[model samples]
Target: MLKTAFAPMALLAFVAALPAAARDVLVRDQAGFAAAAASLEPGDTIVLADGEWRDFAIKLVGEGTATSPITLTAQHPGKVILTGRSSLAVGGTHLVVSNLVFRNGFASGDEVIATRVGKRWSENLRLTGIMIDSFSNPDRRFEDHWVALYGRNIRVDHSHFEGKANAGAMLVVVREGKMPLDNRVTLDHNYFGHRPVLGSNGGETIRIGTSTESMSDSHSIVEDNVFERCDGEVEIVSVKSGGNVIRRNLFLASQGSVVLRHGNGNLVERNVFLGQGLPHTGGVRVINERQIVRDNYMEGLGGVDFTSAITVMNGVPNSPINRYLPVRGAVIERNTIIDAARITLGAGASDERSQAPQSTRFADNLIVNRDGKSPFRAEASLAGIAFVGNVASADPKVEGVVVERREVKLERAANGLLYPVGATAGAPRDLQPIAREATGVAWYPKPAGTRVAFGSGATVEVATGPALAAAVANARDGDVIQLRPAQYLLAEPLVVRRTLTLRGHSATLRFSAPTLFQLEDGASLQLRDLKLSGSAAPRQPGNAVIRASAKPMLVNYTVDIEDCAFAEMAGAPGFDVIATVPATLAETIRIVDTRIADVSGAVLAGHSEKGKEGFYNAERVVFDGLDMARVATIADLFRGGTDESTYGPQFTMTDSSIADSGAVLLSGVQETTITGNRFVRSGGIRVTHSVGSPHTEIAHNSFTATPAPVIEELHYTGPARALLADNRVSQ
Candidate 1:
């Protein structure tokens, strides 16, 4: 019809030659502020003033509303200081910003926080009072994180995040699915400190989510914050979210708090966990489920030896709906803990009923196990779980006591002081008062109890073969050999010595061909629900599944390989060569939830003399959650040989999916923690340094169509100290 009437008169003559859509605009330097904020259109606002401009880079799109927004303010306040080095991106949406100071930025191996703007539900954005620092470099990779918020009604009020510690990822919030419409976001009165930017790619100060999408709910409101000397206060979640509100914050001298994976209704009220004397300190940690840790307060500190000030397992160990439960449906009311050498509660994924949690409720808590010398005590289990007033042991035991830790005394009927007698809390200094002395030393709770139940007493469900030969022939003296998920089919190789625990409930095993699953030579075994392989492995069984030697091995194993194919048999190579091996071993071998296809001579475990210790002193090994279709030729991924000894090869990775593999060699390993992994078209990642390797750490990992993203030390054999921080390499 005449091209729709001249296409609406050519869009009204291109909207009358555009350009009159203003709302406050101004910018200086750098191509006139990137051509006036890229020719703003959406309710514009670009006012930037205050001098000192350099090599700035920005990447923004369009969008604005919610009351005519689209700002980029600066002007009145020290004006502006977008220093050099490069990178800055402000994604689409109702963008708004205030007071600026985004200093000298630069990225070495696999650049991070180079202003890679946010995502998800584009909403009213605001980042007030900004300042993101980072200068000094020793090749430790300087971190420059100001914002990494992945969208959602954003608002980062009163901000300031100093830098230099490359375990980068300052303030990150992720959520891109599962409705609830993302909800109001706010990080009120902020300030996060910095210093050690790369001492092995430090831990997170505020990591937020891990992402696999789905499960939203979303709602955050962190009030009055201040976390100086911030040394890794993580929050690694995979999915599931809820309204979170952490009030009155102040976490000085941190090195604690890790709530990895899965979450629900949240509220960590009135926070304050100051710890100076570090040694593995902790205050809050809960793996999964509906949470509401009320009235928080954990003073001083006391270095833990095992784990948990708070913990709930199963990020993956047999992930029974993420380790059991709807969890009472979830709730851990009124909290006021102190000291805590180790105060684990409802572990084994909230007290295993096969990982059941459907209505977990633990009222008015006040755990002060410090006096009782909590080396690690506190295990809840009122059957399914539900305990009203908790106060662990200031004393009241002896009556089938399920899970209790009670102490309440709140006389604040309008300022009456006295808040501890079992304080149900109404706020009396939030009942934090306890610091009289405790700057370290504390460890009691070794009645030989940490309850790792799997099978025992009157034939526990099923473990087969006379309860797996009486749980490894009456294992004692630190016992732990639990296995029960079924399917074990070996003709040989099932030898374990001393301190055993071969547990399994959903376990599956098969070895039709060249079988061999040894951990002999005084085996210090600890295997969990497993699944082995074998596809003509009488000739394809060199690294079929496992074959360990050495003694001090403490493996928290996880292997799953369906149709079978790990390596070594016909061409001879199914697990070979290994003499000593043990330079700095602590063990945590994991191949992970699998569905792997064709594989040969490259699963793990190597060492003859080079490195002196077999399994290259496996302090940590992880092949990672798999679904590979191919992993042909083999090099260093499972190697540590080439002699000349001196140590190398420590590994760790999450959510793996390596294709046509090869390179992943740690030319002498020492500290490696590659996170949220996803490397396609592999064959890249080589770090060198032997003769007692130094350090190597890579983070957040995400490399698509990889050919090369990071390959440090092409030759240099020692003193390289590699650390490629916060990666996200594109094709």
Candidate 2:
């Protein structure tokens, strides 16, 4: 949850000592915000109002003392939403921004949020509880990033980020042309979800330094974060620069590995990778020299080639940023790998230009192959690589080495010694468990509700009948309405204009008309544990289950449907779930743990029939743990637009199953990520006119009796680059 209250009185006393003019200012509009920012000083606080602000650029450019930094915060945490082509730049020293949400926006600049405005860099800056969702504009032909860090001693923590669809990383720590300065940044306790492939290279969750600055030493730290389905082509966390530390992070169902792509002297330790039987779930890949990989646990990794559990790559003598450099003095020690396909040494050794790893040591490591498969494979000769006291067994009789099914328990020691036998081998005590049960937004706890804001409107229970309309009409913000088990037939479209939740207990809602639900501007709706059924007759040309308009200048509308069932109805030419009209602003749509069976049209559609310049583009749309079966066409599952004038959509589908479906098509969009999904006799994915030619990622999926060509590229004249790795297809 976001922290809305100020700090203790003791801290406020220090701020009170500042100049009288340097006081707290409450700003409600853009003009007031501009005036406040221009006159900000030390110990000043700018509190934004709890509403939506559109197309505002916040360039915080003032220096503050170490003891009294300037702060920009929301009046009510998570309530101040900024949308519609917004940008933020934080420069100068000792500055902070917290609890502000930026969504449904595109960047006219190079980045959506940046530390350096132009030539100035930030120092001692901290960003907390800020959320950046789906900040990309597909109409811009060039590349754009979400967050760019070009400062020293920066800390970004306790934040949430979803749907970075354009090119570049979610967060980038840049090194300015080998200036002998360590960035010393730290990113922790954040949640990064579903970053799609950026067609070409350089699509990472967190990247330090670029090819030109690859030799620079960043010395950054990335820890305690959850990266779920971050299949951004290659290098989930790319440590291009040297002396970076990546530890205690949870990588769940990601296709790429943490790669030391450039530079040397990096440390990757105590990271936990839970593949959960997904293909191409890699652990670590070592590229440059003098890197240490220790005390990590990797389980259920099924990737071959360079994406193996632990891969040591052959380096080019004078390699560029894109190519690998030789590995020297890499120590792989005290780690446990369970059910991984291969632990490769000297990957790409056949390329004579790439030299083999020198002085690399693999010691005190335990590899448990439960299926009696070989865990170690050497692509080239291990000439200078040292292999000392490594154990490979189907059943290792060591304490704390419990193996059940495909998972292994190596947290405790049985005989007071770690497996694989070395002097420095022991269990690590610093590793923390990451929450896997809560996938996306559930990772963040919801605020406790007040007593008066309970049940429908006033803790009232409405039985199954025409009373739902009355209950909805009487509902207030944050009201919960409970429905009993019965069928509700709505004669007209039910329009919701408040923040409310409709929960069902074995209840079914059937629409007699074409449209079922319509969300007005500034409305937020959540439907949980209900069954939504469409009309029995075929859907007309413009009918939809749910319809919402885009009002960018208004509030950021949200619709969350979870643990529900969408029963199969008659065939329809329109969408089955939701559709937005053209020229609408950005909105959020999330469908979790739902089942949709026997649907005729696209599951979700976003388009403008009139071809308006500013069409309705989704800020972020996520589909998790969905079981979709017998759909007519999966093509344009969640479309952005029909042509080039429309901006792309940011879409992510994880842990879902699609069986007997048609082709999935993405055109004129930014990104479409498909990870850890099962396809049974379904059509493949087609990409055309996407901003990044292959910004779509189809990774770690299982295909049984699917089409011959799993991924098709159409009309993309550039280098067709999509990351298709670790897919298990049984033709």
Candidate 3:
């Protein structure tokens, strides 16, 4: 959200007082657009109409004042879709382009949009409220980029980018020559989604400066953006130049991490990496000298080798642009890493030719390992690195390196500097709020909430396993099956088909195997005051404790779980406590007053099934007063898929607390309200790929001991409508 304070009436009066040559103009097609571009003046607006303009190219060469920029915008945001080999070459100074959509298009040249048209570089350019969706070539080879900027003081904000396929990066900042100053670019409040892995390298989502210009200073800022499934072989946002800042961004299920591949004196801070147990998913990969990586939270990272949570690679001194340089004076501090398999200190240690990173500092870092294995894996000796005040599950004996052996415990506090152990860590900042009139569109409708009334019916008391099984099988609607204070071992899943209540009075259900108590369509289950544990050890992939699948027929299903606990349940690495379902059916799941500990999977995971077209939709869901700790990953705490028709999930969570968890990926979802929740040392909440404007409300949430920007909304094209407000976030 980007807000600009401008009085329309005052602006009208000021414009009316100006000469007619300074007025705005409407351009409906390529001819009019060219005419406007040829005679573009300061304080002028060139309006592109709403239609499919195919194979059009625009070379905007204009000179606007610092106070007045030449504007090129659509008649309506997301309405003027540009298709088929369109290109925009911006040159000159003080230009503004907004509210244009470029989709179903292929590049006619190396880039669809370029700031440097020929040898001239644009200056003080701003692109806002723009959307580029599924803009790719026919071969899916990234031969061109969506945006190739070669300019100074450039700002790209509040834009939506989706489905970038092929061989090149989605966005690139090129440096043609050494300038007097760095290219000061700001990329904020943008959404980058679904860029698949290019078989080889060179497919970064955002590449700032190239290897040839790696040493040149590019003081760019990339913030408040969402990177979802942008797994373009490693290095999602490759920093090749020096003195850039990447902060307060959400990287959700993206295969790679932010890499300072060739730069020095760069800052990577307050970013959230929600890997969700995906292969090759990682955190920040460090190289070069005087770089700072701090206050980032990484969870469910499964990558090994250089793709670990934080990999400090050995550098070759005075190396070429493509080769790593000796990493000196690097500081890695105040980061929380949970359920990551590897946190390598010396990534290139095995290669003797690669020089060891020297004078690096690692401090105030917390690594919580649920598995029995050690979190720190060093390939080289730690003699040259400075390791201090780092907390892990156990002593990470790195030969000569000594780390403080203390249990990392994270709790919610009013004012905490760093995220406690087991809390979401990352950039906890929100985008600047944009005024509604700035976007020229209305927000999407907010979903209504549905509250179900539960009945207290007859009670069936059970003392033994057989009695409990029989009672569950014979239970009627609104009947309560109460279990006595005992441990019951079940060999199979208890399939509940009718409406009933399963209450526990100091009772525990230990499953012989990984099984789920499933609830079918038209069935409702209420579980209260029970403990569920699995006898199996935590292994590869685990199973869910509760499962619900929607049938093809549209029906309503409900599951209300309260005051319960889940422990020692070994789920598949990426599985969840609640399994995936379909979108055709209306379902309501409410988990309140519960404590989930030592769980190896997510609390609730939703996804569109493979070969399935629709999403796993829920009419309304709520999570209240939940204490979720020591969990492996909350992958998409409300997960959705890539299918466009799959509607977003409407859900809310209030008065809940989560620590040591993965991200709550609200991509492709709508109408989410997360209020009064306490997130300590956990992954951030990211909303992206949304269907409507102002689709979610996140208010009054206390984010203590966390990074900046607790909540982020990315790549939404609709009008801004008061979504995030009054959240207490500590940096």
Root-mean-square deviation (CA) per prediction: 23.2, 12.5, 19.3
Question: Clashing residue pairs, candidate 2?
Answer: 199-694, 315-325, 315-326, 399-414, 456-480, 456-481, 550-585, 583-615, 648-669
Which candidate, 1 or 3, has the higher TM-score?
A: 3
lDDT of candidate 1 over 1-731, digit per residue (tens): 99997999999999999856676756666676778776677778777767876656555556777767778767775357766654456666787767766566443222323223443334667877776665323232234344556656788776666554343456656554542246467877666664321212223556455434323456767666666555432331112355566666666555555343455666666666656545345556554566666666655544341124455432233544433334435565566555556555444321122344435665666655435543344343435446676665445342323435444343332221224554443223533322212211111111122223333222233456445554555565336554565665555455544435444555655544343444543344444555445532455434444555444232222222222223222244433311223321323445556544455544544332243222343434665665554544322433343221112245666666677655566655645666666777777566554322244667777777775445454334433356667788787
lDDT of 2 by residue, 540-595 (tens): 66566777753322334677889999865545665457776543433467999998
lDDT agreement with native, every candidate? 0.49, 0.71, 0.71
- TM-score for model 1? 0.31
lDDT of 3 by residue, 1-731 (tens): 12244566677899888755676777788998888777777989888888988999878888898888888888877778889989888888999988888877677898988987777788999988777776777553237899988889999987777666566789988876744248899998787767755433456899998778788789999987878787665678989999999987878777877889887899998777778897678899998889999977777888766678998887665677777787899999878787887887777552432577788888777777667467687766676688777767667766755566655564433322224545332223232222222221222111122222354567899998778878877877678888987998777677776777888886998765445576664467788899877545234564777766434322346778998988776444644567655432335678899888766667776553322222343545788898888776553533333322112356788988878765566655555788888778877576664332224688888777654333443443334533678888884
Provide TM-scores for the models.
Answer: 0.31, 0.58, 0.57
Kindly report which residue stretches of model 3 are placed more than 4 angstroms away from their true locations once superposed.
1-20, 178-181, 350-352, 411-731
Superposed model 2: Cα runs more than 4 Å off: 1-21, 139-142, 178-180, 197-199, 320-322, 394-430, 436-731
lDDT of 1 at 81: 72
Candidate 1 positional error at 269, Å: 10
